[model samples]
Target: MIRVLLVDDQTLVRAGFRSILDGEADIQVVAEAANGADAVRLTRELRPDVVLMDIRMPEVDGLEATRQVCADPRLSGVKVVILTTFDLDDYVYGALRAGASGFLLKDTEPSEMINGVRVVARGDALLAPSVTRRLIADVVSRGRRPEPSPRLNVLTAREREIIAVVAEGLSNDEIAARLVLSPATVKTHVSRIMTKLDARDRAQLVVLSYESGVVTPGWLS
Candidate 1:
């Protein structure tokens, strides 16, 4: 079963998510927390597969909690998914940088939310194409210029191209179509790229692609 921990300051919000997620036989809502402090505490104790976290809280916001959970060696298998009211939340990037696997708008469709939990629980990021565009726009607007990083030196020219396309938010199938390759081939390339960069998932690849200057913000336009 995919164990999940719900962390939200509002009782109603937590209840709503629990209700939607509990219906899935493959998922289980293990616990709930109203603050980040408790969220981190419960995470260490229960070690759920996924954490649905709220950004704004009374004490110890989701960003810090995510950092704590992700940074813990004992909690390495845990993934944190930020829950936000807006698609373009200001804290989304920080949360991602702090080791959050992805973010979901609180008002997202029930099906999408359920799938998102499953995605992150299975070690994939929840970065849909739309979310990736917005996230890149936000990073560009903040004047985050790409700089030289030797971490990407291990990648071949083809691998670089694959990573660039990945930053554009294309899935393996989409990338395969664009590159005139089989989906299996594209998936292999992506896996190789991730292994080279030590990226946790596709979201981190997007971040690294931009930060390492493999892809520029203007590519989006």
Candidate 2:
């Protein structure tokens, strides 16, 4: 079962998510928290596979909670998915940089939200193509320059190419079709790239791609 912890300041919001997610056979709503402090505490206790975190809270906001959770060596297997009211939430990028696997708009369709939980639970990023573009745009608008990492030197030419395509938000199948290779081949390349960069998942790979200068905002144009 994919265990999930729901963290939201609003009781109704947490109940809504629990109701939707509990109906899934593969998903279980293990616990709920009305604040970030409880969220982090419960997370350390339960160690759920996925955490649905709310950004704005009374004490210890989701961003800081996410930082605390992600930074914990014991919670490395846990994935945090930010729940926001807006698609381009100001806290989204910060949460991602702080080790959140992805963000889901609270108003997203029930089916999409369910699938998103499963995606992150299985160690995949919940970033869709449109979301990826908007995330990149947000970063660009912030006027942040590329802060390259020495880890880029470890990737091969083909791996670099794959990482760039991944930053474009293509799935393994799509990348395979574009590069005329099998899906398995593409998955392998992505895995290798993640290992080399020590990325937690595809989300971090995307962050690394931009932050490391392997992909720039101009590339999208």
Candidate 3:
């Protein structure tokens, strides 16, 4: 079973999500938090497999909470999927840098939201194609990606190409079609990219791809 923590400030939103998620046999909500502070505390206590975090909260806020949770050595396996209404570029980049596994719009369909939690639980990257584009924009808006670090140097040219496609919000199959490669080949490239970058998941890859200057903002379009 996949254990989850719901961390939205609004009672109604939290309740609605809980209802939809609880109906799933494979997912369970082990705890809930109304603010970032509670989220941090509950995260350590429950150690849920995934955290569906809200970006705007009264205390500490989701970004900081995600940072705290991700920084914890005890909860290294925990994954955070940030939930927000606005696709504000800053929040998207901040959450990823803070180590969120992925980001999802609050209005996301129940099925997609369910899949997101499960995906992160399995240790996969947190990006859905649409979300990747936003991350790319955020990286480019800051003027420079490819932070002066060797973290991204591990990727080969082919792997870099794959991440570029991903930043365009292409699905594995879409990437395959566009690149004139097989879906299996696209998947292989994505996997290799993840391995080389030490990216914990796709969400981080999306951030790094943009931040690391692997994909430019203009290239996203």
Candidate 4:
């Protein structure tokens, strides 16, 4: 089962998410926190597989909470899915940089939200294509890119291309079709790339791809 912790300051929002997620047989809402402090405490204590975190909260806020959670070795298995009210919310970018696995608009469909939980639980990246595009644009607008790092030289030419496409928000199947390779082969390359880059998952790979300049923010468009 995928254990999830719901963290939001609003009682109704938490209740709403719990109501939607509780219906999934494979997912369990293991805990709820009204703010970032409680979220951090419950995460260390319960160590759920996924955290549905609200970006804005009283006191600690989701970005700092996510940073703390990601920093804790004890909670390394935990993946945070930030919740935001706006698609273009600037806080979403910081949350991602803070090691959140992904973000979800608060108005996401119930089915999509459930699927998102399962995706992240299985250790896949979960940014929507549109969101990914917007996020890259926002980062570029702010003049941020990966600094010069020797870590990038580890990837082969093909692996570099694959990582760049991944930052473009394409799935393995889509990438395979674009590159004229089988999906399984694409998956293998992605796995290898993750290992070489020491990325937590594809999301981090995407982040590194941009930061390393293998993929630029303008290339995302």
Q: How do the candidates rank by lDDT, highest first?
A: 2, 4, 1, 3
Candidate 3, residue 37: Cα displacement in angstroms equals: 1.9
- Kindly give the stretch of ten consecutive residues in candidate 4 with the minimal lDDT sum: 136-145
Tens-digit lDDT track of model 4 for 166-190: 8877778889999999999999999
- Could you give the candidate ranking by TM-score, starting with the highest? 2, 4, 1, 3
The alpha-carbon deviation from the true structure for residue 171 of candidate 1, after best TM-score superposition, in angstroms, is 2.3
lDDT of 2 by residue, 1-221 (tens): 99999999999998999999999999999999988999999999999999999999998999999999999999999999999866446688888888998888888899999999998997788787486567655665566677777889888889999998888777898899999999999999999988888888888888788777877776645
Misplaced by over 4 Å in model 1 are none
User: Candidates' lDDT values, in order?
Assistant: 0.85, 0.87, 0.81, 0.85
lDDT of residue 88 for candidate 3: 62
Candidates in order, TM-scores: namely 0.91, 0.94, 0.83, 0.92
TM-score of 1: 0.91
Give the top-scoring candidate (TM-score): 2
Q: By how many angstroms RMSD does model 3 differ from the true structure?
A: 2.8
lDDT of 3 by residue, 97-214 (tens): 8888777788889998998888789866667655556554755676743554577577777877888777655668889989899988988888888777766667777667677676
Error of 2 at 48 (Å): 0.5
Task: Tell me the TM-score of model 2.
Answer: 0.94
User: Model 3 compared with the native: what TM-score?
Assistant: 0.83
